[model samples]
Target: MASITASYPWTTAPLIAGAPMRLISGPSLVHAISAAGGIGFLAAGTDVSTLSENLSAFKSLLSTSPIPGAPSDVLPIGVGFILWGADLKLAVKALSELPEPPAAVWLFAPSSSEELGSWANGIRSATKNKSKIWVQASCVADAIEAIKVANPDVFVIQGADAGGHGRYASAGLISLVPELIDAVREYYGNLNGGGDTSSFPSPPKFVAAGGIADERGVNAILALGADGAALGTRFLAAEEAVIRKGYQDAVLKAEDGGNNTIRTDVYDKLRGTIGWPEGYGGRGVINLSYVDAIKGVSFEENEKLYKVAEGAGDKGWEEGNARMTTYAGTAVGLVKKVAKAGDIVRELRGQRI
Candidate 1:
């Protein structure tokens, strides 16, 4: 395994990442994380139609609030896309036109390795090979295939405990991280002198994601051979996160670590996001909506309930309405309060709590 700084020679900041959370991780959150010496990715998975508007917001924020220790001209942030749902050509074109161009492009859940490769090629061409490509893999098979085919610069190994959409068959971080590291090492070793293992190409850097909430989790993954740590749920409660008050409150109130969250497609169905690629399901806090769905509530009925609850706005949170989808990870118990994105980054990096 290589150090994140070694793999990404652009910055020497600590290897912590604010995992892209659709509709929640906006420019404000991304900038805050980057300013705190951790890498951040703007979530572009929700609306490609708003690509121009989003880029404008990012540019405005970059100019107004520059990263403290980094150069003011360049935005040390990246953009993430759900490969299966994104318009690859349009996304690449929009990102390439940016004045600074995103430092990287993170892709996940492609329909096929061929599609992933095509997107990688398109992004490299558009950015003149300046933007690093990071791919998320949930299992060893996918990791090996990604390394052999797409050849991304970084691979984020997501465990089953992840908050959002993830492979249905994924393993936990404890077992998955080391397994991936050894698999990649063996793959490279095999390519060099059959078994000598003396000389081999540098394998893609590894980052662990899913269920990692605090500094202890970060240290544990690093000890298991991950070059960095990518946090999603931990940042969902960040003050800059553009999430609903109910969602933030849900995370803070959660007490049942892994038991409270379940991997299911009920919420996706209710929200009409059932088109996600096969073999993927989102892990989120169980609520009345999920329970009702499991008990035979129709999708149309659930959608109606969700709309009414959404219309209630902040009052719904006060009423403890169960219509909302509170996406969270097993580490929800560790997120006790909402803080600034920078402070969250610093705390997770063991700088402060």
Candidate 2:
């Protein structure tokens, strides 16, 4: 079967990648997925101050306790960044100084295609290594534009049902993936004199993201023309994910087959995450805080409630008080338990859960 490993460093076929969930996806999670024959990306988008410490820890872990099934000596891990939220130069500098550079650098939500190219060029010049460049897009226009200007090695097409921040008007994977595939094909066709099949090149590989939680979702997206699948919500409950137990339980309990989640910016606003480029919002499990916000509760009132929840600590999460955010996709219902990260990767890759 065709696989992204052909262009990237992974050895796994039917690639199942772990989405870079900020604060949730850590070195342990990435190592677990990579060791399980799938690729994983470390979330370096937020809290840039900890980048060095995190990268060092990842290098130490890889050096001392190597992941069993990973490709020999290749690190088998990537680092992802929220382009709009991170300083590209500093991020690149930090990664360049790493004892072991990542297998790839994943970028998302760039302000413009030129920014994407600039980041890609910086990494290329800094490392002088063959680390692949992967970019995420939520629509055909952005996908085509990335192909035209940035020419990233991989294009992760995120559907609207995906968890976390994404384009407000994103289309579902079923339609978006095929649309991107056709768009890429057409772009290449146009470049080669309208019909020069001989010169047609296959450069950027496509991976489907958002709401893919199981083997069936993987199979469906692959059949839809994606070379692989990237899952976020499904991994939220993984043992290695750096999430509170309360948040994990919320995902496990929200098994309503996509009916229990809402895509909105209430949590972002409540958390003071302003200046996120327009047309982007997050999909998360519905809770009292969200409901209260939707009910037109004033920010001051909601802030007070949030503080109470925060003060309650783990108890707040355990009681479903909604003090903390539970970012999940429509696939929350499909995740039934907290399993090892490696097991989750295997399960999504068709192994029994």
Candidate 3:
């Protein structure tokens, strides 16, 4: 087996970089992160070209870095996939072709209870090793189902404050993380499975995600029994993030003043991306189009306006029409600068908390 490096939890680093500690998990942001001793994951969405290129880029960067345990204590980077939308065949192919296998795998937006199991099985089949799998769970039921089948190495409890598409305007991270942890301990510990002392071990540790922008949030989650923390809104403004300049600029311009961000079914409609389940909406700084159609108008009227905006092309957002809906989370207010991904990681890893 090829030698791999151990993970350095941000909690352990001196300075405990709060604002920048969130891991950048994708091919694009990997260089910035690994350089900072922070874990960066490869975001494998539907774009195969970008994914392939980024994977190669990551390997090249890794080859130049000093290897861990070989006179250097470096850590290998990780990979992330949207379990629901990802092309499984492509994922399997990636596992085989990458120069160095990923240090970990994170699955996003999984629905089926058994999907995780199938994913874990496929990963193990391809690598034939104990590769860690992390799954994002939107609710207790989702968490329970995923733990039942996939039994991931880590579970990310995503709250509504998450920027991307998440559960219906239901639970927020402040409430969900502890709730999920409690639910896991209660059911998995003593009910149907083992009744508090059953033969099986407890479920994998939990991680808190959504609206975690600083070390204070990190400390809060850690106190809540979460093994670690995952952040999306905190990482979106990083220089390495794939979002557009205008979007990044918008994020930097805001302040934590009020509830300006909203979750709505506007962006997916604009982008024409499929497989988005209903009741769940995306949260971001509300734009003119979103405000006019989603917030101001009735459901029927909004639907009509949305269709009209979709037909207008690139002039949508700029013209107050609606071509592309901006994707962001509530933390946009707290984000101010578009620093390098490494800087972001360093900030988080080096936080005082």
Clashes of 2: 1
- In terms of TM-score, how similar is model 2 to the real structure? 0.94
**Candidate 1 local Cα displacement, residue 86, angstroms:** 0.4
Candidate order (TM-score)? 2, 1, 3
Q: Candidate 1, which ten residues in sequence have the lowest lDDT sum?
A: 5-14
Residue 86 displacement in candidate 3 (angstroms)? 1.8
Q: Write the per-residue lDDT of candidate 1 for residues 258-296, one digit (tens) a residue.
A: 888899888798777946888989888888788778888
Can you list the residue pairs that collide in candidate 1? Answer: none
- Of 2 and 3, the candidate ranking higher by lDDT: 2
Error of 1 at 306 (Å): 2.4
Note each model's CA RMSD in angstroms. Answer: 2.1, 2.1, 5.2
- Ranking according to lDDT, highest score first: 1, 2, 3
Taking all chains together, each candidate's TM-score versus the true structure is 0.93, 0.94, 0.80
Off by over 4 Å in 3: 1-28, 48-50, 66-75, 191-202, 295-324, 350-353
Show model 2 residue runs off by greater than 4 Å.
8-10, 68-74, 196-198, 318-320
Taking all chains together, the TM-score of candidate 3 against the true structure is 0.80
